[model samples]
Target: MEIKDSVVLVTGANRGIGAEWVHQLRERGAAKIYAGARDPRSVVCPDDRVMPIALDVTARGQVLAAAELANDVQIVVNNAAVSYRQPLIGGDVDRIHAEFETNVFGLVYVTEAFAPVLRANGGGAIVNALSAVSWFSFPGMAGYSATKSAAWNLTDALRLELADQGTLVVALHSGAVTTPMGDNFPIDKIEPTQVVSAALDGLQAGQTEVLADDISRVIKSTLTSDPSRYAAILGG
Candidate 1:
């Protein structure tokens, strides 16, 4: 669906990809953009069309409140995520829980809260910000990778479930970007705006999934290759 004059809700919009989404949507002439963050005051979108909303996606009450506030919203962007640098088997359990809380469960909860809203609004779209690691595991961040993988599957399931409602479910996958979350990584990273731009473009084109960068594209294409070769690339 076209973004022009469309009402959009974006989670974790205080900065990074979410902020970029808000900016890009405004530039595309969105009717209103609800910028959802834990601290609404931190959202710095300059346009009057932007509405900063206090939302903690993991909290059902907060998600419900956001849904009420953004009642006119048709597009929901699930962007909030936490990356705990730990393993799935022997990692810090608290960290793993925190990661799943924000990255996986939070997205699912927020999606559930917004599903009816989208349906009521005449069938809209849901854009989930996933990761390239959803397809390939990285050492020290296996837990995070697993959450993203689960989210990818959730997006698929949601697509099937929401088909009758005509809600377009789009999954966005990308390698590390030049955001606060990727500051510790040394590899070359794409700009957050570039990633968001590509994703929104794909949404406009009615794509079900968006590979936002070269790394993501390469990783996805490699899925058809020998499993052992792909596993070797992840240093398994």
Candidate 2:
């Protein structure tokens, strides 16, 4: 899982945390980076080591193509996701489907396509960009939170499934990050660079999960506490 000399692929690399991963990976001496985006032309990294690949994680064909093209990738970062802030009750179900399409199923598609490639490359690592909401729910973000919760369990399953192949599945959880995705939220946010840095550090150190911010750490710690305690906070 050493970043140095590793060939990595990051989904949704056109912007946000994915873009930061490309930058930090280059700084860590990654030999090559396949920056997968829905529109490859949108990838803006200046590093020569970066190769922009057209990939839409929700599309199986595109995911397969990316897996074929980036066969040398030793690390796969599942950073592509969508979030729709809407309540579960009386909310547009379409929005929930959209979030799950990108956040949950898209992740599954990407990982499935790349599992063999990772095994071929000496069982590298898969880093999933999860969220603190995976452990707790917020009113307006019910759908987004549910998708992340699904992704959290998915990561755990993948870890066990890929263990025989030596592939390390790492889940990175955090609250809002300073990106377009977090702009609407007024809460304190972690810089994208900081999230990427902590994730990569955890990956190299063979950690299964890395809580990238205080909110994430706190939320995770409360997972085993009495439900009523958090229920009161959620106004249930």
Candidate 3:
């Protein structure tokens, strides 16, 4: 779990949170970072230790190919996701499915593809990029929130399934992040680095879940007791 000298792979590395993950991992002295995006050319980071890879997470073939190519990876960061801001009652079915495909299924494809690689490399770690919405759904982005909710369970399942292999699975959650996905959010947004730093620290600390912001932490604390408390935060 030590970032220093560890070989890692971060999906959606072209921009936003994924881009910051690569930068922070490098700052922490990661030996190498396989920066995966749909187009490797989109990864504009100038770090020599950052190796760009063509990875469209929704594509099973690309996911498997990435595992084969980045065989030395000790940590897999599942950061590739898309949010359509679609709602449940009236949202387009195709967009909702697309969100699930990238957010939930993408994590599945990556974990399935890399579980063996992790075991072979001494039981590494899998860090999934989740959201506070995984705990409670708000309006506007209902479909996106549903995908994260599914991703939360998927992360838990992967953790249990990969435990025998010694892979550490961690779910990192945040509220409004200042990424393209959060630009339209009406709430205050935290910098992507804030979430990335907390996630990495949590991974090193061996935490199964990381609450990266006040909203995420609060939601986690009250989810089982009073799920409706989130209503106040969301202006409900």
Candidate 2 has what TM-score? 0.95
Q: Model 3, stretches more than 4 Å misplaced?
A: 224-228
Residues forming the 10-long window of minimal summed lDDT in candidate 1: 225-234
For residues 58-148, what per-residue lDDT tens digits would candidate 1 score against the true structure? 8989999889878899999999987766556887988878888999999989999999999999999999999988887766788788889
TM-score of each: 0.93, 0.95, 0.96
Pick by lDDT: 1 or 2, better one: 2
For all candidates in order, the CA lDDT equals 0.88, 0.91, 0.91
Candidate structures ordered by lDDT, highest first: 3, 2, 1
Q: Largest TM-score belongs to which candidate?
A: 3
lDDT of 3 by residue, 101-215 (tens): 9999999999999999999999999999999989787678888888999999999999999999999999999998999988757788899989999999999999999999999
Which of 1 and 3 is ahead in TM-score? 3
Candidates ranked by TM-score: 3, 2, 1
Q: Which residue pairs show backbone clashes in model 3?
A: none
- The positional error of residue 228 in candidate 2, measured at the CA in angstroms, is 6.7
lDDT of 3 at 178: 93
